[model samples]
Target: MQNSDSDFFGRQGDEKILYVVRPHPLATTAALIKIYIISLAIFFVLVVLGSQIRVVSSIFYVGLQQIPEHLPGMR
Candidate 1:
């Protein structure tokens, strides 16, 4: 069956289209704002965690050097 402009996705002749579901503009805007805020918070948290990891790794490496090796040809 051929589809008409008013018909969607090969709808039958006896089928009636229901009201289209859509988010309201304000709801869309609020959802976008919420997503943006959550993204920013995650980004900041990752940045802080990354820096802390780097600091901890550096301290670990420095501490490693302070320990003397007991192996034969290793100073």
Candidate 2:
């Protein structure tokens, strides 16, 4: 015979509970500042790279400079 008072399952007292965590405000502010600095650094790098490409290409193609007759196929 199965007894109803035997309490074989469906126990509520043995369950575990979890809690949520929050970050400190100072820590959050510091992280944002760090990210901002990194972003600025990357932006500066891109700008410098773009300028260099422009300068080098302009210098390389600036011409009606005569090609040497010795160069192949220019006869």
RMSD values, in order shown: 8.4, 13.0
Report the lDDT tens digits of candidate 1 across residue range 20-72: 66688999899999999999999999999887763334653666765356633
The superposed Cα distance between candidate 2 and the true structure at residue 4, in angstroms, equals 35
Runs off by more than 4 Å, candidate 1: 1-5, 55-75
TM-score of each: 0.49, 0.45
Per-residue lDDT of model 2, residues 1-75, tens digit only: 332443324445755434335698999999999999999999999999887763323433576366566755433
Q: What TM-score, to 2 decimals, does candidate 2 have?
A: 0.45
Clashing pairs in 2: none
Best by lDDT: 1
Worst-scoring 10-residue span by lDDT in model 1: 66-75
lDDT, candidate 2, at 64:
31
